[model samples]
Target chain A: MEHYNMNLTLKVWKQKNTNASGSFEIYQVKDISSEMSFLEMFDVLNEQLILEGKEPIAFDHDCREGICGMCSMYINGRAHGPWEKNTTCQLHMRAFKDGDTIVVEPWRSKAFPVIKDLMVNRSAFDRIIQAGGYISVNTGNAQDANALPIDKKNADDAFMAAACIGCGACVAACKNSSAMLFVSAKVSQLALLPQGQPERESRVLNMVAQMDKEAFGNCTNTYACEAECPKGISVSNIARLNREYLSASLSTEE
Target chain B: MGLTGLFLVTFLIVHAGVNACIFINDGGATFNAAAHFMSHNWVIRIMEIGLFAGLIAHILQGLLLWKQNTAARPTKYAMSAANENSKWYSRSMGILGSLLLIFLVIHISKFFVGTKVAMYADGGANDASHNLYLEMKEEFQKWWVVLIYSLGVISLFWHLLHGFQSAFQTLGINHKRYTPLIKTIGVGYTFIICLLFLLMPIAFYFGWIQ
Candidate 1:
């Protein structure tokens, strides 16, 4: 593919810490190659910032391979940039045009407090996951994956649910700010697998309760989370979460 | 609203069937007897408790969910353009549901509660069935009541359009093969029920039905 050189204007949020009042600061970058990944472009910007004796914009990134999901950003009004099924780091500069103005901001949610500019505290997600996302398998008691003999249908569903990276993009995209998609993904992943059967009841109940405690919003069926998700996770997962919650709540045993 | 709302879906189907019986033969006596039996029946009375419980649970859950959603995003959309990609019902479910709740209050007050207590309190001076039927007719005759009910029905339909499929999906009925089919069925059910419910008031208002 032929690469084109582009100049872009970026309005980025800057904050010292969680309590700090932040504002958008504009920056202009010159002659960037279209083939550069979004994070690479950020690298160029940080180089420029460091050259000017300024602190680099602190954003989250790790594998940059799209699987880790540590790279989270709201770009030009879309999560993970304009590309479908791609994370922010995987999004390349080619997605934009020559003289484009890009707006970059962090995932905005009360549950996800901002740690710094473009880096919000996503520990809320960790808490939700910890509250129930795993089965209680001991190290030696581990069974072979094939031992369960899950139906192909259920296996596929479990894979799909496991696809969720706990990115909190669902909360960012939802109008109600609901994390149903995230919670549901966790619930469905386990509910579909026999391994998850043991903690199934407590898992959904605790996660939902923790989700509420974190002050996440209830789902109002806005499918934005599914649409914006880099993984293309389904809203159906949220539906599953609700079902699990209901079942757990109505069950005779605690 | 998860379980209770789903339960109400069941109640809606049964309730609609019962109400539709009024138009089955267009016999005032038959309709009246049916209504009297429904109001006085012990089984239905127990179901009424379940219905109230469902309504309360649905509303409380909805409210809690709404509060959390609001808290999740302290900032409102800086611009309205982001809403272009969203479904109208999905965005407005809370508002629409609250409006429907208001309609439900009026509906129960007028028909269920009114027919049960007020209609009988008058010592049958007005025939119970005739009074109940006329009460509905008079309400439908007003253009505003018709308008309100029509809006309520549309909102109800939209709510169910998302809700029915969602409930099934949550219950783990979503096989890729069956999920789409189920969603289609959900849409169809919502459309038919809303259309049928709206027709009653509109037909009565226009004097198509006595």
Candidate 2:
């Protein structure tokens, strides 16, 4: 594809820390290549700020290819960008044109507090995972791929659910700030497999309890999370999550 | 909320069906008899208690859920393109539900109270004395009353449009084959129920039906 260069304006949110209030700060960047990823554009802007003896803007990123789930940016009112099933780092600047003005902000959720300019502490997700997003079985060695027979449909669905990168996009996109999509994807990833069967009940129950404890909003099934997810995570996983949660709650001896 | 909401959904069918009796155009005879039977039957009376309980539960649960959902976002976004992702009615259930609650209060006061008062005055026996059909005609003759009723039905239409499928999804009843089906049925249900309800007010107001 042919690449072109463009100049653009950016309006970015700046916060000193978790306790500090944030505001939009505008800046102009020149000769930005359309081939550059959205984060690279930010890098150019940050370099400009440094040259001007100004503080560089801070944002999150790790595996720039999009698998790490570390990058989280609400660009132009979208969790990642305007692109469907795209992450912030993977969002090409080609989506915009010359003289475009892009606005960026960190994910806003009560459960994910702002740590600095464009990074929010996502340890709440870590805490939720700790709550029971794992299996108890201690398999000392790798098993043969064919050792456990799995249904083709369940395997496909499980693979799809496992594609979720645990990005905060679901929470960011939700009107209620709900993490149900992320939680449900995680739940469905395991719930469909025999390996996940043993801990399935406890996993859903504990994780949901921890999720509720995290001050995340409840799911109203508005389904914005599915629409905005970079992985294109399906909302049907949320149905499975609800099913697992309800079944577990019902049969629990406690 | 889903369970209670579906209960109310069923009640809407019964409500719209009974009210549609007015279309019989038999000088209120068929309509008042059905209304009288609904009010005076003992089994129906007990079911009415359950209906009220379910409605109150749905309302209270909805309010509490709305409160928690609101508190989830302590800081609002400076810019939101939420409409890019979801429909407005799905996200605005709280406001729609509040509007519906206001309409419901007006409805109960206008027809329910009058019908009950007329019954109690007539020794709580099965009586055609209340002339509820005439009352509806006269009450709807007021342009404001018809306007409010129209607005209520419209609000109810939107609520059901999202809610019918939503209740099933909440109950963990979603399926690839069935979710689409439920959505189609939900739209059809909304239109039919709301039209059935809207027909009465517009018909009475315009004197299209006796």
Candidate 3:
């Protein structure tokens, strides 16, 4: 209901491509509305960059809504900015003071290499999901959703796991650079449901193997992933993942 | 670490029961016979092999896991900050586990491997129950040995407090509803096991209830 103008200084990362050595370039922005979303503030900065005949900072964005999760930024040492359970795009300028210094950088991971200024290649996540995520279901064999009769508690848990948007924020926030939370959420989502029964063994085995191959670190339970997750995905999902992986490993059938 | 860790949990229960025999009938024939069975039985020899295997696996896995953990965060944080969110034991598990591993090497080398070597060298002097008991008593008489064992047990207790529930959680035996209970069991089991084990050497050293 209220708007206030603010002045901010940013030390932003600028990279030509994945192979290029990047450095921080400083920029100053004045008279920005407090209600502007973090991305909108970036929009204002980019507008200034274009007017000065400089290349506008290249960053990823699509829906601008948090659901798409295209926006990624490590702001002031915190992934996805300073807010809890909110993505960079959803973060408002109001969260900061009138005069503040914001340090913006791309997600740092060998697997997620820098594509440009603030965009990194997150295709590692795609490969992890592709390894084994869905069960092969025939289109013609339509059955009632209630036919399986999943327990209410299990169903709720499954839905919670499914909330993950594959944002890569968990990986960014982790101190060990672990993707256990993401991989676990994906694994737990299906493991809790009857539809996932057929491919359960292979799904866990393949996904975990893929995760390891991606050079993701083992979880040390720092819980920074949960703290930074926009969807509020829990670290408990990783515990379930460990269980599933061990069970799959022990199963004689597979 | 999985199989070895679970085996160690089992070992804790059995080891506690064996040590509890010291209090049974106040060091009469019953306690001596239990100690004799543990020392001389063929079945226990097989179990000792299993125990050694468990210890090796646990240590190797811990080392591998710690290596991977370090690789993940290759860069140190520029600033010092306390993680107010996580449990202290969870954060310090690596350090505590390393200390426990060091203690394990010393413990097994001194008591386990030492007893075996001494038994073979003396041509059965170390085999008899009364002799074995005297050897143990003599070992405990060293104040430095007692101190080291005390520190080892304290570190072990800390390690178990986190490890017990963590293994269960990793195995997926934990749920939101049951997690609290598992945590309680973890802490309680660690306290009891360490208390019981530490009491034996201290009791022997102080000449309290030997």
Using lDDT, give the best candidate's number. Answer: 2
Order the candidates by TM-score, highest first — what do you get?
Answer: 2, 1, 3
Identify the superior model by DockQ, candidate 2 or candidate 3: 2
lDDT of 1 by residue, A1-254 (tens): 78899999988888899998888888988889999989999999999999999899989999988888888788887778777778998999999999998888888888888899999888888998899988787668667767768899788888988998877777877777778888888889999987899888999999999998998876666678888887888777776776678778999386
CA-only RMSD, every prediction: 3.8, 1.3, 4.1
Q: Candidate 2: which stretches are off by over 4 Å?
A: B122-128
- In CAPRI terms, model 2 is classed as high
Give me the displacement of residue A107 in model 1, in angstroms. Answer: 1.0
Candidate 3 TM-score restricted to chain A? 0.97
Which lDDT tens digits does candidate 2 get at residues A54-74?
999989999899898878999
Residue A227's lDDT in candidate 2: 93
Tens-digit lDDT string for candidate 3 (B95-142): 898888788888778766765765576686645534445556788899
Q: Please give me the total number of clashing residue pairs in predicted model 1.
A: 4
Better of 1 and 2 by DockQ: 2
Give the Cα lDDT of each candidate. 0.80, 0.92, 0.81
Query: Poorest 10 consecutive residues of model 3 chain A by lDDT?
Result: A215-224
Cα error, residue B155 of model 1, in Å, equals 1.3
